[model samples]
Target: MLQQRFFSATSSASKYYKITLRRSPIGLSKDHRASAQTLGLFKLHQTSYQPANASTAGTILKLKELLQVENVDSIPTKEQLQANKPDRGYQVIGKKI
Candidate 1:
């Protein structure tokens, strides 16, 4: 029993959930809004990484309607997250002095 517990605890790599806010929380119940906030989703299309645990699972379930979730192998750093965004495609050629 002790060996099994130890193996289980150490063998499995930690997983992360990539959660994106697909819908607005406006007009929803306070509980829904609070759940979204707890998940670190404050704006539309905002993505946040959360550990795959009971509390995080509960929060995702509570606001599942407004969120899109995917299991990610690793969590992304702030720089990586920013880098994933597409360029606006427009550049300012000249500015008034």
Candidate 2:
């Protein structure tokens, strides 16, 4: 019915728009930090992807003032993402995960 179609459309729309935080926004304006916080991005080089919707796109546009974004169609899962990066800086701090 109508509900099913709506759900299907939402599910299909969930597969695009990869948002990556290529650089840190430290020492930037408070507004930039707030935008990043709104997007759930707090660390450097932390990347997240959302559906290509108006709200998400708008958030990216706001974040662009302090971030480097690439329009990738997809992004790796959190686990896959953690596996690729080395623990160089953390090793000195005696942290390994």
- TM-score for all models, in order of appearance: 0.70, 0.51
lDDT of 2 by residue, 5-96 (tens): 66565433445565557677788788877878777687877766666677877878877755665555466778987899886654365667
Q: Any runs in candidate 2 off by more than 4 Å, and if so which?
A: 1-14, 68-97
lDDT string, candidate 1, 22-78, tens digits: 999999989899889999999999989999898999899888888999988898788
Locate the minimum summed-lDDT window of 10 residues in model 2.
Answer: 7-16
Global lDDT of each candidate: 0.89, 0.69
Number of clashes recorded per candidate: 0, 0
For residue 10, give model 1's deviation from the true position in Å. 10
| Native-referenced Cα lDDT, model 2 | 0.69
Give model 1's TM-score versus the native structure. 0.70
What's the C-alpha lDDT at position 31 in model 2? 82
